[model samples]
Structure formats: C-alpha cells, structure tokens
Target: MKCADGGGGGGGGDTEAEDGGGVNVTLTTTTLPS
Candidate 1:
C-alpha cells in the first residue's frame, strides 16, 4: 500500500496529521515570542 511507503507521503499523511498536531501546537506556542 502507498501508505506503507517510507516517505510517509500517502494515506498515512492523515494519521501523521493527527499525531503531528501536538508538535505543531508546541512549535507555535514556543515560537510565539512570549
């Protein structure tokens, strides 16, 4: 399956998105220059 690709550039993107949102949140919070 394309989702099984090593690049993680396929159906797995959705899963990553869910799993990665926390990273984005922390990034935004830290980068906000508070």
Candidate 2:
C-alpha cells in the first residue's frame, strides 16, 4: 500500500499528473540487480 500527499495547485496538476489521456505517471518503482 502507498499514499500520495499532494499540494499541486494546478501547476504540476495540469502537467505531469496524467494517465491514458496522453501522459503517464509512475508513482513507484523497483529496480532489480543488473
């Protein structure tokens, strides 16, 4: 489980915070050993 504590007042909210609407946002990631 996770949480998103955001305070984006239309700046990034109007930008990077998108999905299948043309943009994408990955909130978490895990990198396996190369």
Candidate 3:
C-alpha cells in the first residue's frame, strides 16, 4: 500500500540522516586530534 511504502521511506531517510551526522562527528574529532 502507499501508506506502508511512505512509512518505510521515512524510516530510511531518518537512518541515513543519523548515519551522516555520526560520520561528520567522527571526522571532526579525528581532525581535531591531529
């Protein structure tokens, strides 16, 4: 159904956003220590 697909898409978007934020934080920390 359309509703189910929409929900799944939203969840995937949230996960991607969180992953991107985590990666940015890790890069910043690594750079700061060098």
Candidate 4:
C-alpha cells in the first residue's frame, strides 16, 4: 500500500510480508523538495 504524494511534503511506503501465519509490516519514507 502507498500513500498519495504529499505535494513535496513527503511520501511513505508500506509493505506486508506474510510468513507461516505471521504478518510482518515494513514501512519506508521518502523525501522530496518542492
């Protein structure tokens, strides 16, 4: 899942990994100049 571009404010990415009935979530953020 990804959030819409925050108009140069910032952006983030979320990933979910499933492993043997376990769920792992990873989050990443990106920065951009307007």
What local lDDT does model 2 show for residue 31?
17
Best by lDDT: 3
Residue pairs with backbone overlap in model 4? none
Which pairs clash in model 2?
A: none
Better of 1 and 2 by lDDT: 1
TM-score for candidate 3, please give it.
0.39
Candidate 4 structure quality by residue, lDDT tens digits, 10-30: 212122223311211111222
Ranking by TM-score: 3, 1, 2, 4
- C-alpha lDDT of residue 7 in model 1: 33
TM-score for every candidate vs. truth?
Answer: 0.34, 0.15, 0.39, 0.13
What's model 2's overall lDDT? 0.28
Model 2 over residues 1-34: C-alpha lDDT tens digits? 1122222222344554444222222232111111
Candidate 3: the clashing residue pairs are none
lDDT of 1 by residue, 10-34 (tens): 3344566754754554444444533
User: Backbone collision count in every prediction?
Assistant: 0, 0, 0, 0
